[model samples]
Target: MTKILLHGCCGKMGRVISELSKKYDNLSIVAGIDKFGSDNMGYPVFKSLDECNVEYDVLLDFSRADALENLLTFSLKKQKPIVLCSTGYTEDQLQLIENKSKELPIFRSANMSVGINLISMLLRKVAPVLKDNFDIEIIEEHHNQKVDAPSGTALLLADSIKNSLDTETEYVYGRSGSSKRDKNEIGIHAIRGGSIVGNHDVIFAGDGEVIKFTHNALSREVFAVGALKACQYISKVSENKLYNMEDVIGLDF
Candidate 1:
């Protein structure tokens, strides 16, 4: 069994991942770290990662940006692989993740949904081909408590689209009045509401037709499963490597 230390154990995402851990025979969650003193569905929750005595095979971070530094430091010190499911990292924080990836097996993704990652790959392929006549726009919806806008998935899709295009693509957040989109602009929109798990849409608008691809995640367990799969892959992969869902899923096209 691959032992894991799950951060943010008190949050909704963490809770779902914990429950899903029970369903996988090859995976076992050994310890949990949370800011709140709340126990994780019966596991002893530590107030900080520093207090944990047990050694785990991997660390799964679903915590906030503020907590990331500590987790990264811990992972580096322990020389363990890490799977990051948190979002809203600033440029400096991203640089840190990039730097950390140089020494440890790190899998960082904003959205852990396999479907969404596939959408990212698909967008890269479709964006450039459709760029001539189509205007691309991205829309993402999440739960009310979600703190990020445009979402990690939205940004991932945007970056994939940008990478595929020969020219640099500009990202335009929701527009104001009297504003028009440039041919090179990729519009990203965000919607937050109650109890929505996750939804992302990429639309290509043309003169006579519209092409759309959407991925809707109805349960947090889907992400948990993805994270688990990532952890499994991480165990076998070498250090100083960065990977994503595409790498884990082994999708070449």
Candidate 2:
């Protein structure tokens, strides 16, 4: 069995991963780490990694970026692969992750949904062809309780569009100020309200026609499932590299 130590085990996505992991015979969650320190389930829940005594193959982290330092340190000490599902990382933390990728296996994705990763692939293919005449904008929506705006997924989509642009593109957050849109500008807008699971739309507009690609996440299970699949994949791999959703789904970019 591929044993897992789940971070953020008490949170929404963490609970989802905990529940869904049981459906797979080869995968099991052996322990969990949550700030809330509640484990109604049979597994032990620790407040921090240093307190955990149980054995696990890989760590699946859905915790916040602030928790990365301790978690990354412990994972490195254990020589274990980790599926880091947290967003809102600082630039220094991201750089730290890149440096650690050379020492241990690390899996991180802007979005865990398989469909979203495929959307990233689609954006890459379509962006180059449409950039000259089309104006691009990215709009993302999430639940009001979410802490981050212009979600990691939104940035992922914007990055996809930016990579294909021949000219340097400026990222415009919102149209609050009174100014006309620039040709080299990529607008990213965030919407927060209700209990929205997730939604992303990338629009390309021209004089005559407009094209928009959208993905709607109806349930949190999509992300949970994707992370579990990635967990299973990473548990088996011996290579020390930073894997993305593409690595789990057998796609490039």
Candidate 3:
């Protein structure tokens, strides 16, 4: 069995992962870490990683970015692999993750849905072909409770397109105030409302025609499943490196 140390076990995604893992015989949530501890999760939930005493093969973190330092410290000290599924990390925290990955296996992704990752791949393939003639725009929707303004998946898609282009390009997040759209910029807009699972739209517009690629997440189960898959993949990996969904899905990006 793959013993899992579930971080942020009290949150929505964490609870989803915990319940989903019960359906798989090979996966077991041995322990959980959350600021808000719970008693009915079928496992021990600690307020912090320091209090966790159980043996586990890998750690899956769905906690906020603020908790990243502690999670990384715990993982590195234990020589354990970790799958980080949180978003809204600052540049310094991202760099820290990259630096720490040199010593321990770390899998990190903003969005764990396989469909979103696949969309990123598709953008890479299609962006270069359309960059010169098309104006690109990305629209993302999430629940109001999401702390981040533009969802990480939106940025992921934008990055995929930006990297593919030969010319310099910038991202404009929700334009306003008397500025015309730049030809070499990608526009990203965010919408937050009542309990939206997730929605992303990538639009490529030319003079006469428009092409759009969209993905809608109807439920959180998709991410939970992907996280579990990542946990399984990282648990077997001996290489100390920063991994992503592409690694779990076995795709070259």
Best by TM-score: 3
Better of 1 and 2 by TM-score: 2
Candidate 3 lDDT tens digits, 129-230:
988899999999999899998999999899999988899998898989897888998999999999999999999999999999999999999999999999
Cand. 1 Cα-lDDT: 0.88
Please name the candidate that would achieve the greatest lDDT relative to the true structure.
3
> For each candidate, how many residue pairs have backbone atoms clashing (under 3 Å)?
0, 0, 0
Candidate 1 lDDT, 1-253, residue by residue in tens: 8998889988888899898899899989888898786753667778899988887898998888788889889999999999998999999999988988998989988788888888888888888799999999999899999888978888988898999999878898987778667888889999999989888889999999999999899888889999999988898887587888999879888
State model 3's lDDT.
0.93
Return the lDDT, model 1, position 189.
Answer: 92
Which sections of candidate 2 miss by over 4 Å? none
lDDT of each: 0.88, 0.91, 0.93
Q: What is the C-alpha lDDT profile of model 2 across 1-253, one tens digit per residue?
A: 8999999999999888888887899989999998789849568999888899999999999989899888889999999999999999888988999999999999999899999999998998999898889999999999999998879999998988788667799999987767788989899999999999999999999989999999999999999999999998999998899999888889654
Off by over 4 Å in 3: none
Sequence-dependent TM-score of model 1: 0.96
